[model samples]
Target: MSMQLNRQLPMPADLKAQHPLSPAVLERKAQRDREIREVFEGKSDKFIVIIGPCSADNQEALLEYVHRLAEINEAVKDRLLLIPRVYTNKPRTTGQGYKGMLHQPSPDKAPDLLEGIIAIRRMHIRVIEGTGLTAADEMLYPENRSYLDDVLSYEAVGARSVENQQHRLTASGMDIPVGMKNPTSGDLSVMLNSIQAAQSSHNFLYRGWDATTGGNPLAHAILRGGVDKYGTCVPNYHYEDLMRLLELYGERDLLNPAVIVDVNHSNSDKKYKEQIRITSEVLHSRSHSRELHKLVKGVMIESYLEEGCQPIEGERTYGKSITDPCLGWADTRSLIFSIAERA
Candidate 1:
């Protein structure tokens, strides 16, 4: 054999029992879930903001960010629904570098999967208990999602993983709203196909058991733009792009026809500062087309306590990002209110 097995880890159920959530926390999470669902279901017109750091590398800093989100959620409750991102796993284009907190719970230390699992769970529980915010996470690994299912209110299949079969099938099995981004190639058709798969029940092998999903009707689209053959970033958050999405949704029998503009990534070309301008343009686009306004449910923004990204080595800035650069707390706060004003 080419590989040796490590110690078997505890099941997600057992781990939950070990660090169980309080009734109050569970209830709070349920409420957040429902509010987010209403946006995708068309029962509510309030805009949704799935905003946070690109990778949650530390518990204290992540909690600090979530608590701030809670305060803002209170102010914009009438016009916007806020869901903070506590993503623990990050996708690397070439299969190298820091995987995430799930791989290295302590960034300065070496990777330890066992401790990493417990650390991530505790961090998520802490976020819910302290801030009353059930954050969103990227489903980078389908098998690992069980560890977070109870605490996460939302999930997004990243642009790189949108076409994977396991990702689509697992998303179908999930009950919470899952946003599937258009592939890096900019193929909207592939994205639509993935969504169709996620919204349709399928019998498949999962976690050593035969499982069938009831179809996640809330699975929708996240247009994060894409890269062309020449390796140029092609943005799709414009008025024309949104109208095209509206037309695309019309051709499908998909439920709750909706889309979320990911203001970072290719959409902003990873220029964190562009998030503000992109968001303004998207809100302006909504102002012009009623169809565009109705179809776009929210925006996904990458922001942290400090603005921009930094290297892992050397003296770390207290709240700067270790992964992708993010809008600082000041800019993030201002952007939320601006979105509320326009919404």
Candidate 2:
């Protein structure tokens, strides 16, 4: 075999037993799960902001950041439903550096899957127990979803994974909202198809067993923009883009049709600061056309306590991002208010 034999880690049940969630955390999670579902199901008018660091590199900073979010949620409670991104597993385009807190809880340390699993589970538990918020995470490893499944309010099938059969099948069974993003090559059909697959029943192998999933009605699209053949970034968050997506959605037989415009990624071209501008434009688009206003459910923003990013080695500015660049705390708060006003 090409791979070395790694030791088997403890299952999620045993791990959760060791670090149990308090009744308070469980109550909070149920509340958050319902509210978020209502938005995707078109039952709630509140806008959602799935905002946070691109990668949760440090726990203290992340905890502090969520605490600040709790404060912001107070003022924008009427207009916003916040789902902080505690994205622990980051999908690397080339299988390279800083996979996430799930692979290396400490950036400087080597990969230890067992410790990483415990660390990630603990972090999610803390976020919910400490802040009364059910966080969001990427379904990078389908089998690994078991660890955080109980705590996550939302899960994203990233641009790269949206087309994979396993991701589509797993999403089919999830009760929570799952956002599937357009691929890097700028293919909307692939994303749409993934959503379709997720919204229908499936029989597939999962974690060494035959599993059946009843379609997830909340499965939907997330436009993060895309990269062209020439390697130039192309944004798909304009008024025209929303209209186009709506038309395409109309042509399909889907349920709970909705979209979430990602302010960062290819839309902002990783400029980091452009998140604010892109957000303003998307909200404006949502406002002008009632059709768009109903179809556009929310927006995703990459943000943290500190602005921008730094090298993973020796660079430890508290809340700054170690993966993709993020909008700093000051700008993040202002942008959230602006989005809420328009939402």
Candidate 3:
């Protein structure tokens, strides 16, 4: 074999025990989970904002960012539900570069999976305990979900992973809301099929044993736009796009027929500053039609302390993203208030 086995890492159980969440944190997470679920289940009319850094590289900077969000949450709590993105596992298109805090606790340091696991859990715990807000993370590696399952209130299946069988099966089992993004190829059918799989019961191989899941009714759609055959960014967050998605959902017998428009990614063509305009446009689209207003749950924005991203190899700026560029604090706060007013 060409690959050498690295030292065995602790299982999720061991890691959980080592860096356990206090009862207060657990309680807060439970409450936040229920509230977020209510939004997807149509029990609540409040819109959700899954906003934060694209990749949480530094715990200090991330916590600082979340703290700021906490203040904004207070201002928008009546109209919006803020679920900050503590996305630790980033999906790399080329399977290289900074993979997030789950691979390297420190961006400049080497990869240490064991330490990375502990660090991520601890950071999550601190976020809940300090801010009383649970977070959202990307379920990049299906098997790794259990490590943070107890603390995470929301999970997203990236556009790249939405078509994977394991991702679909794992999403089916989650108790929290799992947002399934349109695949990079821009196929709505494929995305809906994945949502169907996730919203149905499944018995499959997970970890080292056979596991059965009773399905997740909170599974829903997230449109992050897509790449065309010739590499152009094709956006699908317009009024027409929402109508099309609503029509598609009408054909399916799925449970929580809702969608969250991701304003960044291909929707903005990775132009970070365009997030503000794209988000406003989605809200404008929602306001024009009652069907769209009901179908569109909320929007996702990648925002951090600083406005843009920096190279990972150099001396990085604190709070600036090392992965995807994100909206800075000032703009993010203003946008949240604007969304709350419109919502």
Candidate 4:
């Protein structure tokens, strides 16, 4: 006997049909994007700090957190260019778990994707307006770009997607500075290829229209450690490794040769407390080696209102990460201050 299949289907309506950006928002985003590009080009020496929740599950909590960050920005205005990571979506390795607030705001509930998109956009806009600080986010889905392209200042292609042709093509057309992270296996070559692809002109299909890209000159690299079965961080951001990578890029003649060191991830072996040590060590190495120092542009840290992380299955904890363990506020503050002093 043949069995019938039961499958749920997505609605045909466009996600942005309900909510669209006003011209004012687009202008604001354009100005912010220019400033970000300036910083990436070394025209502005401000140390870019992209900080926020590991996954923004609650809009209210994220808004409150950015308000505090804005205050910190005022205090460190001379030294840092603050960009809150209002990351609404996440990519899983084996494609399991909660994904992010966009997929499942409530752990036990079915995905309200339409509502999720609106919630994320609202939260992002609020952060930009409320804190008066620029925002950064990972571009996970190309289709979702239209909804957010007007509000974000900086864009990132995460480790899992850096080598993807679709992501590289998308980055090529982005007006904002794009940071391409090294692969999860700690391969710098993949990042270099991704960066090169993003910095070159390309023609691809986009939105039912033929599109040609002007190419992004502000595309760069991000060094986040690698994970293996034994659980050790490889390709540690040491002076030699960084120097070699930079030299390779120079040889390849890539437009942007700078890199951002991700202080959390494998670099810290996922130990939130160790992020401080790793950051200090990298800075010290850079200080002694002029070559590496020139190649090192900034740093990225995973931080939130609270420290560490809690599982989504049990009772949820406040301000903690649902995906990865992040450095708590206290540790984050101390690290930022220390790094600023070093700068």
- Clash count in backbone of candidate 2: 0
- Candidate 2 structure quality by residue, lDDT tens digits, 1-343: 7998889888878888888878888888888889999998889999989999998899999999999998999999899999999999898889988899899988899998999999999999988877887899999999999888888999999999999999999999999999999999879999999999999999999988899999999999999999998999999999999999999999999999999999899999999999998899998998999988889999999999999999888757788898999999999999999888889
In candidate 2, position 305 carries an lDDT of: 94
Q: Residue pairs in steric clash, candidate 1?
A: none
Q: What's the lDDT for residue 103 in model 4?
A: 73
Note the residue pairs that clash in candidate 4. Answer: 307-328
TM-score of 4: 0.90
For each candidate, what is the lDDT?
A: 0.93, 0.92, 0.93, 0.79
RMSD of 1: 0.9
lDDT of candidate 4 over 257-292, digit per residue (tens): 788888777787777777777778888887887767
Roughly what TM-score does model 1 have, to 2 decimal places? 0.98
Q: Answer with 1 or 2, whichever has the higher lDDT.
A: 1
**When superposed on Cα atoms, how far off is each prediction in RMSD?**
0.9, 0.8, 0.8, 3.1
Q: Model 2, residue 232: displacement in angstroms?
A: 0.5
Model 4 weakest 10-residue run by lDDT = 8-17
Under the 3 Å rule for N, CA and C atoms, how many clashes does model 1 have? 0
TM-score of each: 0.98, 0.99, 0.99, 0.90
